[model samples]
Target: MEYHPEPVQQLILCCSCGIAIPPNPANMCENCIRNEVDITEGIPKQGTIHFCRNCGRYLQPPNYWLSCELESRELLALCVRKLRGLSKVRLIDAGFIWTEPHSRRIKVKLTIQKEVFANTILQQQFQVEFTVANQQCDDCDRVMAKNTWKAVVQVRQKVSHKRTFLYLEQLILKHRAFKNTTNIKEVRDGIDFYFAQRNHAIKMVEFFQAVVPVRSKSSERLISTDIRNNTSNYKFTYSVEIMPICREDLVCLPVKLARSLGNIHPLVLCHRVGNTVSILDPNTLDAAEIQSAAFWNNPFSPLMNSRELTEFYVLDVEPLGPTRGKLMLADVTVARASDLGTNDTTFLVRSHLGHLLNSGDHCLGYDLTTCNFNNDQFDQLDAGRIPDVVIVKKHYPGRRKKTKRRTWKLKTLTKEQDELVARKQDLKRIEQDYELFLRDLEEDPELRANINLYKADDARSVMTNGGTDMDETETDFPEVQLHELMNELDINDEPDEAMQ
Candidate 1:
C-alpha cells in the first residue's frame, strides 16, 4: 500500500486584522488574536493597600505587617504581588509614577514579557493604580485592645525583696523572651505577664527555668464554649515562683539541714552569684554550693536582709588571702548606730570581705549575735550562738546613700524591622565585596580578557539587530569568568607558614 499525502486547505483571512492565517477558533492571526486578547483582563484597575499608621508597615495578608517604607521599591513589590496580573505573566520590570504630590494614590507601570509561541516574545505594559488605607495590624490591634490575652504568667518570689524580679527582668530583656507577651503588670513582689497564647507563657516559664531556679504550676479556666460545635476555649495561667533566698542574705538553717550538711553551722549566709547558690558558714569559713532541688527541699529563712546591715569599724585586721580573712578585736569603744549597745565588745571577724578591709576600714555586716532564738533551734539544741558580727560587704564611711533600684523595661524590635536591617547590612557588604571583585577582575588581565569576549559577543548581537550604540548603562552586571575565579581561589587556598 502506498501512503498518500493529504491535500492542503487554503489559508483564511483574519476577521479583525484581515490577514491571511490558518483556520482557528477565532479565525484570527497570532498578532490579531494577541491584540484582541487583553493580557490585563484579570488585572485590577485600582488596588487597595492597608498600612499601619504608627509603625509605617504594610499589611501582608492574614495577620502580618511588613516593614515597608512609603513610596519605596519594597512597598511597590508588595502592592504588585497582590495584583492578579502578576500570576499570569513573567514580570520584566515595574516602576512607580507619582501623579499628585503627597497623595496616597500611586500609579504603577508594569512591563511583562511572555513567550506566546516558539521563539516569539510578547511584551506589554499596563498601569495599576493603588490607594492607601489606614488599618492597624494584628499586634498593634491586640496592644490597643488590652483584653485580648489568652494566658497570664504570674511570676512571684516568696522573699520580701524585688532584686530577683529585677534580675529576671534583665534576663528576659536580654534574651528577648518578653517579645511574645502582650502586656506586663508590676505587682508588689512579682510581675504579671499577659500573653496572646498559652505557649508563649509556657515558653517564658521555660526560659526562667533555664536561667534561674524556678518552680512552675499551671491552671486553666474555661473562657467560652461553643456547645453546638463541641468546642471549648480556655484561658491559662502559669505560676512561676523563684527561690526565697537571694544574694548576701543572712539565713539560719534548720537543725535537720545543718546536720545533713555535715554540721558546718546553723547560721548560714546565702550567697547567690550567677546561677550558683552558696551557703557560707561564717564560723567554720566553709562554703557549700547547693543545687536548686536541694535548696528548695531544705529551705532556710533569712534572719537578716542586706538592707538591715550596719557599718562596723575595723579596729584590727589580720590579713588573709583574697578568699579568706581573719580579724583581731580590741577593747576600743565604738558608737553603735544600729542601737544594739555602745560598749566595747571583742569578736572574731570571718568574712569574704577580709581581703578588701584595712585596719581602719569600715565594713557593712549583720550582727547575728543580737538575733533572738526561737523554739525551732531549742528543740534541736543546734541553735548555737552566732558570731558577734559577720561582714557581708566593705562599707565606705562617707558613702552611705539611698541606692536606686534599676528600672526594667522590655525592648523589642519587629520581625520586619530586624529583617530589613539585616538585609540592608547584607546588601552593603555584598556591594563592597562586588566592588572589590570588579577591581580584582580589572587588575587581572586574563579575567578582563574573558569578560571583554562576552561583551564583544553582546555588541555583535546588537549590531546584527541594526543598533549602532551598545548601551553600557543597561548592562549593570558584567559577566564573570567562573574558571578564572576558581583558579584564583585555588591559588589563595595554598597553605602558608603564617597559617601554620
Candidate 2:
C-alpha cells in the first residue's frame, strides 16, 4: 500500500538562513536556530557573592551563612542557585573553572538545554563570573557591637595563678568549643564567653562540665515581652566556678571525706585535674577521684601549689618495690638545694615517685618541716604522722638557657581583652603562666594527648640552626614528637584567607 506513496515529505527552508530542513517547528537550520534562540539569554554574565571576611562564610541570600570550600560540589550548587534565569532551562552540566584564589573571583561554566519551537531543542554553554564582596555577617556584626549577647558564660576560678585557665584554653582550642561564641572576654579572674543564642552558651557550659571539675548555675532575665505575639526575650547568664585545686597541689582533705575515699591519706598530691580531681597519697600511692558534686559540697583550697615547690638535691633513692601504676614506694635521702653547700642535714622520706628519681638528679618537693599549717584537717593530724618532705615531680634543668623558638605551635581563639591597656605586671604574669603550661605539656604525657599541635611554618628554621628541632644544648625539655603533630593542610577543612 505504501508504494503509492506517502506524498514525498516536503522540506521547508530555514526562516533566517536559506537551509532546507524537514518540516517541524522553528523551520530553521541548526546554526540559525542557535543564533536566533539563545537558551542563556536572561542569565547574567557576572554576579556578586557576598562573603564574610571575619567568619570566612558565603552569604546565601535572605540571611543564611554557608560554609563551602572552593571548587566543591556544595559551592557549585550554591553558585548555580544564585543565577536568576536558570529555572527556565534544563540544566545539563555545571562546573567550576579554576582561577587565582586570592583574586576573589569565581567562574562557573554552565550548559543548559531548552525547547525553542515544536521539537527543536537548543543547548548553550556559558560562564558566570562571581566577584566576592566582603560583608559583615550577623554574628560578626554582633561581635563588633558590644553587649549584643543573648547568653553569657562567666568562668571563674579563685586562684592566684592562671595555670588552670591556660589548660582550659588549650582544650577549648583543640575541640573548637568556642566556634559559636560571639565574643570572648578575658576578665580579672577568668573568661567570659558571649553567645547570640542560648543553646550555644548551654553547649559551652556542658563542655566545661565534661572537661573540668566545675559547678555551674544559670540565671535568666526578661528583656522584652510581646503579649500580642506571645513572645518574650530573655537574657541568660551561666556562672561556672572551677574547683580551686590544680595539678601538683598539696591537699589536706577533711577527716570524713578522706575516710570515705577507701580510707586514703588526707595528705595527698593533686595528680591531675580533669572532670574529677584526682589525688594521690605521696606515702601510699593511693589514688582517688573527687566528683564535682562531692568537691563543691565540701570544697577546700589547696594548702600549697607548685609555686611553693622547693628544689631538692637527691642524695639517694631506694625503691621498696611496692608499686601502684607508675608510682613506686621508696625511701629517699634529700637535702635542700639551698642547704647543699652549707649544711650536712638530710631527711629520709617515703615517696611515690621513686621510679623517676636518680641520685644526682634534682627534684621538687614540699618542705613541711619548717612550715606551719592552720587548716583544721592538718591540725587534726598527729605531728608524727606527717612526713618531712613530699616529693612532687622531677626537675628538668636548662630552663635558664635562651628561649629557643618552637618548631610547632597551637591555634588559639580571637578574644577581646577586658583590660583596655595591659600593665607590665599583667604581661609578665601571662608569660609566667604560659611557661608553666609548656612545662606541664612536656612533663605530663596525658595532658599532651588531649590537644592538637600543628607544625609551625618556621619549623625547618630551627632544624637548620640547631641540627634538630630541639637541640640538646638549646633545651633539655622533652621533645614533642613529629607523629603527635598534624600538617596544616591535612586537617584544615575551612579555607584560610592567608592560604587563599
Candidate 3:
C-alpha cells in the first residue's frame, strides 16, 4: 500500500536548533523567526528547543509525543476518555483514580512474570530492578517504594509480555500544552498559566460578570448558540457575580483532562444563564478564565462559588485542539480551528495520532520499579539511570482463566548481560581512542605507531587488538610463549646509548 502524506496545516515546525513554532512560508517556524529579530540591548539568547512532552527535543520521529507524567492507569483512563470523546465527553461514570505520580518500588526476582490475584482474577504488572550504591536524596523521585506498595493491587486489566508487544503496535502519545501567547514568562503548565499577577483573564471574568443581563435572575444572562442572520452567533441574557473557578480546583483533575484537550486549555463553562469560554491564543481566550466563565454565567454560580463548593471539582477531560473532535498527534490543518479554548471543550486529533492513541495499542500498562538518581542526571550521553518498577496494575480483566492470571515481571541483571553491557561500553571507549589515534597520525606522522589505521568498525585497522581486517589469533603462533619477551631486543637499544 502506498503511504500518502497528510496535507500540512497548523503543524508546529522546529528548526534543527530552536524553539518550534507554527510553520511559515520561510520554511521555518518562530524560533527561526526570532532569529531574524533585530537585537539592540541585551535580548536573552535563544535556548535550544526541547519538547515538553517526551525525550525528543522536537516532536520528531522515534520518540513518541511526551507521555503523561501520570501513571499508566491514569494514562489508560485518559486514553479511554479520548476514545469515548468520539461520541461525547460526558462526566465519566467510573472514576478509577490512580495513586500519586510517585508510587512504591519493590525489588523482586524478575526471571518469570509474577502472577497475583486481584479480586480473585488474574492481572499483569511490571517491576523494574534498579541499583544504587545507597545514594540518598532529600526528595525521592520514587513515588512508590518498599512500604508504599505493602498491599498488592489487582489492577482491573491483564497485560502480558506478548500483549505488551501488541499494544506497542501504535504509540499512545503523551499530550503537551503549547501557549502561543507572546509572553513566554507567563506561559506555564495547567493552572500556573492562569492566576499570573498581571494577566487579563481574571479581570475579564470580573468585567463579564458585571455586564450579564439575566432577566429573571437579576444581572444574570442566558446564552444560546443560535443562528443570527444566518450566521452562527452566541445569543446572550445576563446574571450577577461571576464566581470564577479556583486554581486549586482545576489542578485536582486527573492529568488526562489536559491530554483530552490536546494540551490546550479546557472549556469549563456552566450553562446556567450566560457567558462562554475559549482557550488562550494569539487571537483569543484566556484558559485561566475557563473557570471564571463557568462560575460567572451559571445559574448555580452562587452555590458553586461558595467556599463549600470547593469540595466538588470540574475539569474538561478532552484534548483541546482543532479537528472535528479528537486528540490525535497529527498536525492541525485549518488555521481558524487551531484556537479552541477551555469553554469550547472541543478537541481535535489527527488521524495518525487518533489511530496510534487508540486503546488497542496503549490499553493496559505495568510500571517499572524505582531508580536512585537525580532528574538532572541524564544531561550527559551516559545511559540514563533506569528506575525499577515500584508497582504495576492491569487496566482490565483477562479474557480467560489463564490469561486472567495477574503477573509482574522484574528481571535482574544476568552475568552475561552485565558482561555484554560492559563490553559495549568498552567498545565505545575503544572507538573514541581510535579516533584520537587517527588524529595523532594526521597531525604528526611521528606519533603513528606500528599500525595501519584503516577502516575498522571498532577503532582502526590495526593488525592486532582485534582490528577489522585481521582477527587477532594468538593460536596462529602456537610456539609463542605468553609474556615471555621481557628481554626482547626491541628494548635492547633504548637505554644503551643514554646510560653509557
Candidate 4:
C-alpha cells in the first residue's frame, strides 16, 4: 500500500472581528458569536420559589406541592424546571449553591451548551437566585380555616371492650390504609378518620370492607351551592360499623342459622374475626364463617366475653382422639381456681382445646351452671344437654404488676384523644385490653403475619433481664421468634448539612 499525507486546510478570517477561525456558517470568531447570540437571554436570573412554611413543602406550578430538603436533587430540579427557556439549550450540568438558612434564598448554578453556528458549540454558566416565598397550600389553608375535611370515616364497634378496634388499627397501620387521612380522632368506642377528598374516604371504607366485616352507610351535608355552575359543596360522612363479634367471644346463633351452617351448635366460640366471623363449636370442633351480610341480616350479640371468663383448675383431661386441625374433643373435669380452697365444686365438660390442655393445668372457662340466662334460645335448650363448664383456653400464670417490655414492638398511628376526660376505670380497662391484644399476637402466628413487628430499642437488655416471666410449665407460654422481627430504622427529616 502507498503512504499518503493529507493536505492542511487554509484558515478563514472572522467576518465581524477580523480574527482567524475555523470555517463555519456564521463566518465569525467564537468570542463575537458568544457576544451576539446569547443562549441564556430568555432564562431568568432571579425567580421566586413558593414554599409552605407549615408543611415544609415546595409548590410545583399549577397546584402540586412537594416535599424536598434544602439542597436536595429534588429542590435543584425544581429550581431548574422553573426557568422559562432552559429547554432551548442542552443542560450540561446543574447544582445547588450554598446559602444561609435564614436568608430564605436558594441559588442554583447551571451550565448549558448550545449550537450557535455550523459545527460550532458554545457553553456558558449562569447562577439563578430563587427567593423562597411563603405560601399556604390548599390543604393547609383548609386546615387553618377549620374546615379541613371533605369526608370522614367513622369506624365503630358496639362491644364492651376496645380489643376489636385496637386490632383494626393495627391492620390499618400495617397496610398504610391511613396514609391519605388528614387527621385521626379517637372516640369512646370508635375512631374517626378525616380525609381531604371523598375518594380517599371511599378507599378507606373499601379497605375496612376487605379487612373485616363492616356495615357502612354514607350521608352528605351540603356546605354551599352554586346554582349557575350547577356545583354543590358537601361534606360526606361514612359511618362504618364493624361486626360486634370479637375473638374469644361466645356467640349464641339462632336455631335456623345454626342448622344452615352445617348443622353446627347454636353455642359457638368466635375463633377469629376477619372479613368473616370464624366460629368453632367447642363440642363438635366444627368451624363455620359468618359473612357480613348474613351476620347483619340476623344480628346477634355475644352471649359472653372474656370478662365473663372464670379461672378453672383442670383436674383431668381425657382426649377422645377426634381431631379437627389443632383441636381435639376431650372430657375434662375442672374446679374453679377461686373455689379450690373454699369448696370442692367440680364440674365435667367437653372442650376443643384438649390438644393444648393437660391434667392439673389452669384454664379459663364459662360457668354456665350458676349463670342466669336471659335469651329465649338459652331457655329453649335442654338443661341436661348444656355443659356445666366450658373451657375457653389455657391460662398462663405469673403476669407482672408492670408489663414486661417485649423484644418486639408495633407501629401505631397518631390519634387525637377525645375532648372529654377519660375515667380512671376506663383507662385501666383500656390498658388491660392492650395487654390481652399483645398476648394474642404472641400466641397467634397467623394473626401477626399481617403485622410488621419491629425490634424494640432495648430488646437485648430486656432479653438479658428475662424478657418474660417464666412459668413452671413453659409449654403454656408461646414466644415470638426473633427472626420474624425487623430492626426499625430511624429516618431523619432534617436536610443534610454536608450536601452543600
| Candidate 2 structure quality by residue, lDDT tens digits, 134-190 | 999876676675478899999999987889988898888767787777778888789
lDDT for each candidate structure: 0.62, 0.84, 0.24, 0.84
Better of 2 and 3 by lDDT: 2
lDDT per residue as tens, model 1, 11-76: 999888797887776666777757766666777979998877866778777655677555687888
- lDDT by residue (tens digit), candidate 3, 1-500: 99999987666546555555665445444344344432111211111212332121122123223223333343334333222122421222332244432332212211112112222212122223221112222112111122221111111111111111111111111011111111111001100111112233333234333333212121212333455555432222122222232211211112344344455422122212123223221111223223333333332211111111211011111323443222222321211122234334321212212222322221111111222323231222123322111101111222212211111111111111124324665556434433322332333332222222222232222324442333243223111122221222233121111010
Ranking by lDDT: 2, 4, 1, 3
Candidate 1 ranges with C-alpha deviation above 4 Å: 1-48, 60-69, 72-96, 99-104, 109-126, 133-135, 273-276, 291-299, 321-347, 373-375, 378-385, 396-500
Backbone clashes (count) for model 3: 65
- Candidate 4 structure lDDT: 0.84
TM-score of 2: 0.81
Global Cα lDDT for candidate 2: 0.84
Clashes of each: 0, 0, 65, 0
Q: Which ranges of candidate 4 are over 4 A from the true structure?
A: 1-30, 36-48, 59-74, 77-103, 112-123, 137-148, 222-233, 341-343, 400-404, 460-476, 486-500
Model 4 worst lDDT run, 10 consecutive residues:
491-500
lDDT, candidate 3, residue 30?
A: 37
Which pairs in model 4 have colliding backbones? none
What tens-digit string does per-residue lDDT give for candidate 4 at 1-500?
Answer: 99888988878999898988878888888789888999889899999999998878898887778889988989988888899998788999999889999999999999999998777789999999999999987656645543478999999988889888878888886677776667778888899988889999999999999999999999999999999999999999999999988898887898888888997888889998889999998998899999999889888888889889999999999999999887899999999998988998898899998898899889998888788878877777767778887788888776533445667877777777785417777788889888888888887898889788888888798778663544445544777889999867635322211111
